[model samples]
Target: MTFLKPVLKSILLTLLIAFTASLNAQTHSKNGMVVSSDKSSSAVGAAILKKGGNAIDAAIATAFSLAVTHPSAGNIGGGGFIVFMNSEGKTTTIDFREKAPLSATNDMYLDQEGKLIDGINHFSAKAIGVPGTVAGLFLAHEKYGKLPWKDLLQPAIDQAKNGFAFNWSLYNAANYFTKEGNTNPFMDSYFRNESGGVTQPDEIWKQTELAETLIRIRDKGRDGFYKGKTAKMIASFMKKNDGIITKKDLAKYEAIERQPIKGSYKGYDIYSMPPPSSGGVALVEMMNLMELADLKTMEFNSSEHLHLVAEAMRRAFADRAEHLGDPDFNLNIPLDKLTSKEFAKKRFQGIDMTRASVSDSTKYGRLYDGENTTHLSTMDKDGNAVSLTYTLEYSFGSQMGSKELGFIFNNEMGDFNPQPGITKSNGQIGTAPNLVEPEKRMLSSMTPTIVGKNGKPYLVIGSPGGRTIINTVFQTVLNVLEFEMPVNKAIEALKIHHQWLPDQIVYEKYLLSPDTKKSLEAKGHTLKERNNMGALMGITYDPEKKIFTGASDSSQPDSGAVGY
Candidate 1:
């Protein structure tokens, strides 16, 4: 009987283990209705949904949490754009782009010899622009949120205070942070202990200062961060670090509401971020050009399909390099001309079915200039969706941190061209399309998009990658809309990009078919292989069940989605 009892106990233990594994598998299943770049961030959004808050509320909550838990790529110290579609069928564009500091000029990154010094660190105080995250979140909540503002922010505050466990992705990024060329000295302290060893997984890391900052904003509203002590602290840090940001800059910064750029493809309307971000215009232009061909019938990953897409990207990129900039700054952009059907038709004429075009021979019209930026996107149940993009230019921005503020600044100044006669002082630059100017927002490739079917919104998606962002979003959309693949498969599909100037088509090894790659090479398209391209997050509606299905890029380790 004693031997039998011991066997029974062993059986029970095995059963318990099996049960736990099953539960975990279900929780982490890819079929969840809501997806995000961070699981915790997705949980925050799920909480908002469970609280009866709409998708907009969930998005705001998730965004706030990302700022705290995923600061490496998500942040409160940066700016971005949001494209939202309401239940009433109205779509709006919220532009919270980072404004250039009053002291910024077109040549800030130029050395005395006029050579561009890699002095622009996205992580420094000098690189910090007027932060728009707080204002942007508040604006979305005020207009579309059902939950209390405090409720939306509380999750982030709690996460920051109680601390979050370090994960492999964070650890890997921290290791990347330690690389020599990566500036931002403050990261050394934040990411490591006194021994200079990376923080292990499950180690608790608290951002007390950031927590306090969130609390003040939660209690006193946006004024707490923009006009009060936080603002003062930011200004002081900027001043101490050779940054031009001032209290006036913070106080004067306002989030603008702009018109969204809209385009149609395969009977669906696509709403995306507009200028200052070249995402919407370029995406629209690229899609429009592709619509001229029979892409749906072409086999997925076939040489012909890849060739057409790559050629379309080349033409669109040529247009981008030739005439795209912050509209308020550059008068020569010819936005209407660039987006015109006539121009698209003319550009499409250059596609040779079997070969890529020569850059100089493409004739993409004329060139204009100027600046830098990043992006994010969100959606909620009630059919409300938002796509936002922002940036501090280079990674770690400015290489200058505010010793007191405990945060780094943006080095967006380098978005400017140092070559004289190329860029103007008022944010208008001819050679480098993303130059810096007093109070002007820099240009960006962050494209947050929402696609509609049967006159209703069906997909909410966006990604984070500099020049490749546009192509990533475009290809993903085609994968879903044209290829008729599921959301996850669509996201997992191989990505290919060609920016025209590089004269090379970059392909992810996972997506390249040996046959297709060989064929592309045979046709004279120079191919450059890379490991990954961008981080894409999206939620698509399952019309039959009326439930949303979310998908996050596998390229990023920490991003995923959650739902009630």
Candidate 2:
């Protein structure tokens, strides 16, 4: 009977793993849904939703789960924005973007010669900003979450403690960071197996230290990460590694609840994150401009249609660089003028329909941003929706992790303009509005957005593409609202980006036909082909039918829209 007990226990363990995997296999439901970059994380959110949790609760659980499963960008060491729309149609946003440590300087990344020091802004401990994720999640849960806080984080803690299957994406990222020539010493130790190699696919990978940290957070809420043991570990690591963060910095960190940037496009109300993230402002500005054009008259993806879109993008992004920054730091951002229809009308007047607008850095402020972050969108049957986007800056973030904490630190400080006034053609921008300041949040392009029609959420969407984030959200919204495509089809549609600098149209490889490409070139547009742009997570609701539809960007592997 004792021998049989061992075999039964083994069978039960195998069944549990199979059941977890099954959660990833399901994709549709009539009640609630969660779309994200990783399968396990999405499953966690859907499970929360099934348990009668609201969209915010699902989002909190999903995010923490991603910190365990999707290590590349999902993180406790990073920060981001969240736009939430309640069942009654009230809208608000949480700005948890990382802040520069008190010890940081405007020219910290510059050499004595006043030139930007190569790689230091991105590769060293100096790149880390004081993380705000834990604070942000705590604030959201305290204010809106229906479930117990510990319950929301339990799945992530379980995954970290009991282990989950290692997949190809995790393997590839580990391989890249743990390779011999890699500069980050911390990556190798954390991501490699005891045998000193990348963990193989299907292997059960665990993070004991991260599990302990999660337990602290589960027990103590915000203080778990922002004070006490976790805070001490972070401060000590920074002190030993030349990083600028300290216990005081972590203690003072607070996630702010701010009014979302509001605008209307063809009667649909749009809500998104405000400054510290240029995403919302730029997105609304572009939408306002696009609203003026009769886009429905043009054939989809036709050169004329794309040309019109590109012009609006160029104008809005030019303003984004010139006017946007941390709101607390730059008090005169003129939010009213930027999002007003009158301003969009004025900006639209300058567009020459026949030609592509030249990206003039001399005229605009300056522009540069990175390309690795993650986004998740959740919607509950009760009419609540959450659009959240977060990151660790560069992929795997500075590629640095704490041995004691078992989490990566963000290189978000690099988002600050490193030099005071050096705007370079190679995508380096040193603009006044974004210059580093003590405790100031760095500028970001993470656009988490929600669209409302007739007092209910019509679309919940966002993406993780650095500078391309605003455009991705813009296009996805347009696809549904203007062109009237379904949510899944909207996400599947080809995307394009033109960030007012570089003066080029970055298009998905198959987006433009030869003739369309030639026409664009003849209009003086420099076309650069990229394999893909932002990985979007989106959900839309149909009021008349009382139905919910969701989709994850096709380009992201293992990403899905899990619903039940």
Which candidate leads the pack in lDDT? Answer: 2
Residues 1-564 of candidate 1 have per-residue lDDT tens digits of 988997997788668545533322212222224456678888887877777887677777777787776765566777778888886668988887787888877777668886655545343455567777778878877877788999988999999888889888777767876767865567766677435677777788677777888888889877978988989888877777667789999998888788888888879998988788788888988888887887758888899988889888887877776667777788677667666667777778767987666655234433211123333445555666666655555555554555455444555544444344543322223455556678887767788898988767788788877778899899988888877877667767789988766678999864587889999999889898987777777777766677767667766667676766
Superposed model 1: Cα runs more than 4 Å off: 1-33, 121-124, 176-184, 193-198, 331-333, 361-377, 392-395, 418-433
- lDDT of each structure? 0.72, 0.89
The TM-score between candidate 1 and the true structure equals 0.87
- What is the lDDT, from 0 to 100, of the residue 396 in candidate 1? 50
Instruction: Flag regions of model 2 displaced more than 4 Å.
Output: 1-27, 194-196, 365-368
lDDT of 1 at 194: 34
Error of 1 at 141 (Å): 2.0
Number of backbone collisions per candidate: 43, 0
Question: Lowest summed-lDDT stretch of 10 residues in model 2?
Answer: 19-28
Q: Give candidate 2's whole-model lDDT.
A: 0.89
